[model samples]
Target: MLWLVPLFLLALRAVQAWSPTDSYAPGNVSCADDISLVREASGLSPNETAWLEKRDAYTKQALREFLDGATANFSNSSLVDSLWSADKIPRVAMAFSGGGYRAMLSGAGMISAFDNRTNGSTEHGLGGLLQGATYLAGLSGGNWLVGSLAWNNWTSVQHVIDTRGKDDELWDISNSIVNPGGINILSSASRWDQISDAVEAKQDAGFNTSLADVWGRALAYNFFPTLSKGGDGYTWSTLRDADVFKNGEMPFPISVADGRYPGTQIVDLNSTLFEFNPFEMGSWDPSLNAFTDVKYLGTNARNGTPVTKGQCVAGFDNTGFVIGTSSTLFNQFLLQLNTTSVSSFLKGIIGDFLKDLSEDYDDIAIYNPNPFRETEFVESNYTKGIVNSENLFLVDGGEDGENIPFVPLIQKERDVDVIFALDNSADTDEYWPAGLSLISTYERQFGAQGKDIAFPYVPDFDTFINEGLNQKPVFFGCDASNTTGLSYTPPLIVYMPNNRQSYNSNTSTFKMSYSSSQRMKMFQNGFEAVTRNNLTDDSSFRGCVACAVLRRKQESQNMTLPQECAKCFQDYCWNGKISNKTAKVSTIENYSGSISFITDSASADAASSTAAASSSGTSTSKKNAAASLPSSNSLKWYVAFASLLGMAIGLM
Candidate 1:
């Protein structure tokens, strides 16, 4: 008889892909190299800037093709010139937020709408946006989207869907991370040992191991498929070698994390923000603004040379560990590690380890021989940690609520002209982007000690929700003159919040696994939100995207604005307004309702009732209650249980 998986709540794998052929082999991607380089303390790496030069050429060509399709029947030669010109071309970026799998799949859907690779995405869709984009960044679960596509040589989202379930590869979450599902038929007992052994080996080799390492191995089973590709190992740095990434065929991938000091849940605006690309692991944030050779992570170096730990360590920044570092919110599962489901004897063994981990490494990555330890630029707030053990602890990117990886994208050095930030955050009790991410980012950009980055104006959360700005698309920094305080014109931000007209894509971030059908609906809902249901709701959606692209170029060239673009700016730009008072979702026929999309549609009346139920009790108890109150930024347990039971896992 087939085994029926036990019902459990919490603990989720954000991105899923792949498995190998009949038998599992060693690994595919190669790790480590013979080269060494000088680590720079300031500015973009020479390597990345050189790569961006080549990448810009690819995107410009792609954008010219997109513009031809968008403006085929138009008569404006000047507009076409700016759109198609090598110099006047707009630099575009796409950012994904972290909300577990919801962030991953919803992000995938948004990309599908922007990508030419998806069927019908180009015609009357935003498909060409991906090709036009130079940078792709993700936070928490969002990195799952970036990593999955990059690992496959930058394959299309459709391809990820097509290959899944054919042999239980690429999104077979039927087996929880706690259980082995792919080609490895080992029972949960064997798999647990396998994970523990791997981590132990790393520790045995004189490297420090933490819960993040264990979490990485658990999450990698679904997304990291190279274990059987026959090589030393697969890692995030290995992507620099893939032909697609190396040839500049794919947008540069950035993974984000916040440096967290021990014994604190508070992630202040001044906290060190770190980013990981294939070439380096560092931060653009003013505090310790520097990058280290990601390939030489475990090496003991003095100003970038091997010293104390003479032998450099390869595979230290494991691809899975790096991705897991950005999404450790699910490490709450460790609390469930000692549950009775396994065995009393094994439970006792792990329960001991859990106690020790709770003291210091609570769901965070531990980077030893921290590249910034002895560097001159190391700020005092960050110096203490390195002083103790030369360790750097990094946590989930969204810990400070800047769920979209905007730090790197906004770096003036990158010269990004526009950022299409995908906000799939569970900002409300119903799970939608409430513009909190934007608010946090804005405050930090202009806040005390945060003077380096430039950000456009974002209204209070009250204004964001009350004005219906969170329910649809809006643009910030539409005019270059507005950011007069910055050294350079900040990139225009096209904020796209999640909405539900088709699929209820606002699933809780804590709900761990999802079935193929539910996952596909998320992809569809994401596509609808980005296209506004293919102009079925707002006909101006595509035009607005084009206008955001054209805004900067228009200012730079002092070109007469197109009438359509002028209207787009007037409609989407956030006028300087502050409102501490909150608002409701736009009830305009185009938008479904102000209620949580996760709540079923009983009618407008039922939405209010459900919202009430949420505040009176928990979301699980709100099916019969009135409307729910807006929740705090932290993940809600009620949403978690309700989501786990209602979809994916059929607990009932």
Candidate 2:
């Protein structure tokens, strides 16, 4: 999108060699013969011929130099490079502003190239001609060639002819040269003002005027060509003119008053390359008419005053009364007067509304790089039902909305137990510290209590997901490490609980039931904070680590959790230093709520002592109850049953 100045210069040079005259003109020959042919034309006057000849010579020399590559010497690569530099990115903002302005003019029928001259006088309207020239200059680089010729300047000969005096004998002849009975130019300054206001309004909205706006304005103009022909000299009279206003063509007779007409019909001129569409004002409703206030144009005009036929003073503001008109000329004026300065000023008041929109788009892209993966999530939402269960809990960490709690589904009722399974695969470098900062965050959030949290750094997903499934709230840190004789592969399954099943395990089904909303909220709060911290440290592994954590949670849902107290008790037996007597007592208490079932007196005595000791350290016991639970293994049926029972009671 960034164009170098040298490229623009080259394009400009190439465009200069293009035909200066209209390409549609009868021309089967080169530029050299074209001027002579025009001079020999029967209609052109002597002065017109002379002026055309001089202009032709100048253009020919310019074209020759451009074609010969002489313009290349003027191409400024240094300026282009400077503009393209990092510090000069602001220049793009400027170009965009200019482009916006040009589009506004194009939307207005005023984009046409025309020569205006006072009647019965030699003074030409050089200002209008200069404006047209500037427009043509802006249309270089094939911009005009490709149906974008919004405006162009009249030739010098056309200017002279258009300025000829009406009383002079040559006046009619001059008018024939300028108007040519094709396009009629209405001679009224008041009509021009109405058109100008309408065009200005359209420009404010950043919309381009179509051919309809021009045709509508032209139709309006032909109705009342002069102030003497209509009441109040309003522009709307021309629009209501019955004689000249037609749907398909210009109905009026073209004369010296109209200026050189471009085409035989309105459609012909509209179809030409320089054709511009004025903005359509559309219909105004009576109900919405009350909403019109001081901001309306021409608000200060006389009460009940009619500007022209079918147009009247509706309201007024500080600038002027708002004139309601059916003509598109009003719309065209609105389009042109809508300046970028006002737009920018309004934007300053409103702030950059698009900034947040752009940021949101970026966030979406960053979070969802793979469309297939996103689709998979969507499908999971419908079929699996796990994504729906992950709920978002807003935690108050007291840092003024900074703190977040990240608890896995397995440990939803307790503290997080994260096991970082670091991948030391062949693709990973040994220098990369694995999951150290992640461990630190857990500690920072949970303090010394976090030490009980589990982190099993593994080199592969098989061990991390299968062996580490039961380790609730586990985190894994892995990379391709040649030192560990591991190869890189995805999905890495990095963060997982020791009790959760592997993604590829046939017998090991996942058990957690967290929902996508919950996961998103959890990730938004937890991982986002972690990523922010990592960002400060210039860490590049946050994305990978965050993704692994999400995947682990997802996989855990498919694996089943211990359904019975006995299974839970056994699962946690090896996780702590509990005596066998205490374990038996806890299991029995969980299931039957008494020790009467124990047949042996010594067993009962041991159970009583163990209960006494646990009650004495009730606070520590409460903390260790969930923390001391070992990862679940299906092999130990009896122990698993006891552990499950113990876990059930512990949870209560």
Candidate 3:
């Protein structure tokens, strides 16, 4: 009788509702007769160059506030102002790594700490750094965080936090993607119906669809619930049309994907890295150094010209699809359709369609009418079967092992001085990063695929963990003199790895869901990680960040590093030590970070334990580390269910 309620509601709703409409299908657009959409990837596009001019003015106040807050401990802080007044402003970029929802929630907290709008951020955290930043890059789950902010007109993290589980609000991950009803049974059925219809509509329009499409649609329900058809009409290219973006109130956003050929099983480090920004979608890698108007993506082109005279296609760069392309790793989720509790009707639609696609490469996103087909400039340095093919296949950006989205920031044309690399990769069995992504990017610099790109030198994985590089924040490329054989020096890397914090944030990367309390704890841990527990770990952490941002500019201006800045560099920057010892496990499955809030029963237990440890003469740092054991009282039932689900997923 209880099970009959869902079937009855679903049947009644199917009769009452029409399929949700979305901009999933490609449509014709007026291309202004002779306008060419595709162009050579020679340098920064004119659109980006012009946008930077607008951003320069906008960042002035933000940078000022940031610098003021950063250099509070310095005696000769006036020198910093003089340097800035002399047109030596720092150019900062932040890249977020991919690790499913863990990255999204943790990255959200990092952004919140860097954001001026988050309460207490300006006073006690690294607020205004996000505003001062010139660019933001993300891939996979990180792209979810970036897209959520950009699509919502650059909304604050506080806004997202405030509206967690309200009806139609985003971040309602209680039911996971497989069953996204949360507390409402009706919304779950309606959502699955919408996802099935959206994918079918794309297929009916002669486009190739895959599990990535299904994955993206489910992602939208959690990230864009308030928008029409869950933001189905939203296209990534349309971000430029937003007033806030046009006014340069937000940093330029970039999402990344990796090109794969038909039947390719693995994407290696040499694979072409494609980036999607508001203006263009392309790669700067030598294999296919070309870009096309992202809005006109579905149009056929040859040698940078339209294949059909005076005709072009639009609405092909659907926001969900573009993000889906970057996060194709999640296509594995859809592959588990038979195991999920999804209605047989919706499962049939997805299962039937996926059976036709390559089971070995279900992660691929098919871009038919390949925009670069027969393009001579792209063919000149072609790799494998890309140029002559009529379809383009792209997969997860992190598939190549460069999970942190640093490729875009290191491009010489961007002139970025430093990048804050927020790593949340699941590189270990226990799900923690060990600087492998940085190593991959560094090794790419010596290959032909690297071409004009330069990345900071990083040591092997053994040294990364043995030297504690993967746990706390460390600076790479602190000295330009260490890097050679590149046309230009790479931006300094501010590596901030997701280590044990106020919570054991190393939940499995495939853990698809989080209770509200668990999610908030992850966010709090991320915020604490970035702020170094609001500088409790080191009062000089903020000053060190400022020094990193100003490192290149100060060198270029022939000015010496400030005394305080030099000391900060000595303390936080890696000193080029190598280790022969084998790497040990990096994940500590306990709360070891400073406890700020006690929202759940786990937190309450942590607080009680910390009190006991304090009386027993435990050290302060150890107490903080041992206090975080995360679980929610309100969600104890789900926690038990999720534990079983997690174990099952692990076995599978």
- Best TM-score goes to which candidate? 3
List TM-score per model, in order: 0.79, 0.14, 0.83
Q: Candidate 1 lDDT, tens digit per residue, 457-545?
A: 56655567767788788898888886675546889999998899698888766556678888888888899898878767766667667
Per residue, candidate 2 scores C-alpha lDDT tens digits across 192-225 of: 3344444334323232222222222322232212
Models sorted by lDDT, best on top: 3, 1, 2
TM-score rank, highest first?
A: 3, 1, 2
lDDT of each: 0.65, 0.19, 0.72
**lDDT (Cα) of model 3:** 0.72
Cα lDDT for residue 483, model 2?
12
State, as a TM-score between 0 and 1, how close model 1 is to the true structure: 0.79
